[model samples]
Target: MTEGTIPAALERAAERFAAREALVDGEVRLTYAELARRVRQAARFFEGHERVGICSPNTWHWVVAGLGALYAGATLIPVNTRFTARETIDVLERAKVSALAITGTFLGTDRLAELGSSRPGTVLRIPVEGAEVPFDGVSEWDALTGLDSDFVSPAKPDDVSDILFTSGTTGRSKGAMSSHRQALSVAEAWGECGGLTEEDRYLVINPFFHSFGYKAGILAAILRGATILPQRTFEVRETLHLVEAERITVLPGAPTIYQVLLDAPERGNHDLSSLRLAVTGAATVPVALVERMRTELGFDTVLTAYGLTEAVVATMSRPEDDANLVAHFSGRATAGFEVKLGEYGEVLLRGPNVMLGYLDDPDATAEAIDTEGWLHTGDVGVLNERGYLRIVDRIKDMYVCKGFNVYPAEIEQALGWLDGVAESAVIGVPDAVYGEAGKAYIRLRPGAEVSTADVLAHCKANLANYKLPRYIEFVAELPRNLSGKVLKRVLREENG
Candidate 1:
């Protein structure tokens, strides 16, 4: 029946919900059949390619382009739209993508022009906002529609469907490869938990490049026949407007999302009564936040989940879970995963949905997944008697900065290139708005003078906005242990 893969799932959705509204992107409203036909038309453009990259904001185009690549038997590479031209080019070059679909301009920058020198043979400039200027070597996505394709070479269940890059502790990003079955399996599990239905309207505030938005938001909506409304960026007033205007039933994001909505002055001005289900995770959800989200925000169910890009949807809270439970623990293992506590309380997972491996990095993959088939997640957590999990700490130095994972090692590495840089240490500090922000302590080279502005400028050029340290300080020397390894714990203690 070819029913175990995402392409097969989309076909089923096309047949089962042909007349149902499948996607609602700004001015483009498409039903299931219309969405399917559009995906096929775009798929014809991706033929004879092995890997296709999409670097654009969330919209009808991102969905169609991503699915089109998969339908043409090409692995999808979703580049972060927040990435700088250098960072975006690095991902595209490393993946050796055969084609790329990017936005023309966003936030005053011409992204298509920025990526002009990229190696992709075929380029499609996606229309976002403002004027869509023509690029010399790029084709327009809007003009690529209406073509037909009779060729059928959709990916199989075991084929790698997407390569999502996640920054590692090594200061470089690693691409995690999820097969078709693994991606769709987690989506099915997530949809079943949220009780998604065609009658539901889903607001996707999370970025499309992220697993939360792609797997849980888009794929889950497709499987359960929910209507997807893709918001390019999250603004509090716009979110409220959409909730009231579209009668949004299912909304999921980090705890910060709900917190903002709760604290907004215009919250009561809009009719937010249709918000029913909210799936949140990434940072600790305060008990007060959960209660307020339910009673004040009018959400009937609020759940928390814990997972990384390697194996998304490992554990998630159930609808019947109490507010306290939802606030404290991520629910029991789902998506056919077995969660266990490894050495030093490190979280371990064995499942059907665990990623195949990191792209072209066997040694790294071996370190992540052991011979016993368990993926050793570098997180420390405790499981209750009922198997619910509460993440207490991270064994790795990675921290969540405003819902995005920021590796201090990366910033530290970037700092090494500065003229006066000698040694550096970065640690997480508590923040009221972002939950946690990076604090960098630096020691200059002997007799070298560098202003704070110099370091800040270097960081601004090298790192993404979320990866930039919120605070910086100059120190004479970094605290070290007997073996001369820098003691980051001492830094966090002294400063944080």
Candidate 2:
């Protein structure tokens, strides 16, 4: 495969696996050669655009358009499908996007009309099945893909590949600019860490906009010549059906996804024997869940990885790791990365996969990456003698209760062991006695009842009084971003 750019990697994949199945969406399949041909054609259409925005679901169109933009030497910007009109406009304007490739409608929302007149670029609508959306002046997908397929723009390793906007938990989201070299490095690291083979059928449920889905999911698959089955959204029944139908070999998502599948009544009805590898992260994963995924779910290997948008996949557990290590730790640093702890117990990373900088935010970029080139992750963690890293919590998520520092991730991990608790989040709230106390928001299993007193009693047995939650509130569900991370800022704002 080519060393730096995604389009170069695509060209190599097409040569090696020309007739192999490259991408699969519902009723849409493309071989590597066909996919490469379309990408080249779309590249010709995007020849003049400096920055191209892609707003679509996890489909063949999204993958093709993104790679095409790269091939045409345009920096790709993936817009979150869940963003509001104002948020979308903000991204388009901030990125200085000159063109957009978007689906007509996704999940009952007319994406074109949502941006409306606020968009500052040319819009290109990707036609979806059974959708007839009208637009005044926009290019169609057919017209773009019908262009000449021989044109290929030159892109260097230092060129910006994509600008990924961070989830605005702390404040306004900053776009993390990643170069072609960084993107290719992360993709190769993920594939090597996961032991992905060309024979594996990868089911990508993560959103295409996120670094995990785009770089680790699609780009990694292309690097290894693995067949990509892109799912628009996560649905337990639908995923189960796809797993059986496609004989998927590699499946990765958050811990909640596997938990839901284990709890499904119809899980046994589906033939999941083809599932061999599973990778998950984003929250506290219980050891029991890891064991169940291996023993009950029939997965040969279950791995846990840790990374952020700035560095795509820094640490990941190997296939030989035990369930406890995989659950309790985020694994050692991957090859080509140096992971260390700061003076305040914050995790710091230095590697090729580290992003170039935040787009248009020099101050924020300087604050993030220090003079020594270390990316301050702002996550509290501990490195064991064996070199495994255990994430305690976000440095901002730590709170003082009665003069003792308390980490919400520790409390959340303890809560996961509770019988009826399906999911939980702890935020520091104002307390009369202590300076700040933790308030636990919990979502119980369906039809399982557990009161606040019961939860407190369980915590008393498992945790110290200072570390125990001061208050408990039962909720139907926890608010999560598109990436499946609990919106702790939302919880803190609501309950603070």
Measured by TM-score, the strongest candidate is: 2
Residue clash pairs of candidate 2: none
For candidate 2, give the lDDT of residue 23: 97
The TM-scores, one per candidate, come to 0.81, 0.97
Spell out the clash pairs found in candidate 1: none
The Cα local distance difference test for each model comes to 0.84, 0.88
Model 2 alpha-carbon miss at residue 488, Å: 1.1
- Model 2 over residues 250-357: C-alpha lDDT tens digits? 999988888888888899999999999998985578777788899999999899889998988889998888878888998889847899999789999997778899
Q: Write the residue-wise lDDT of candidate 1 on 137-224 in tens digits.
A: 7788766665774546557888889999984333578999999989999998999888889999999988888888899989999999
Which candidate's lDDT is highest? Answer: 2
Q: Give me the runs in candidate 2 sitting further than 4 Å from their true place.
A: 1-3
Q: How accurate locally is residue 176 in candidate 1, as Cα lDDT from 0 to 100?
A: 95
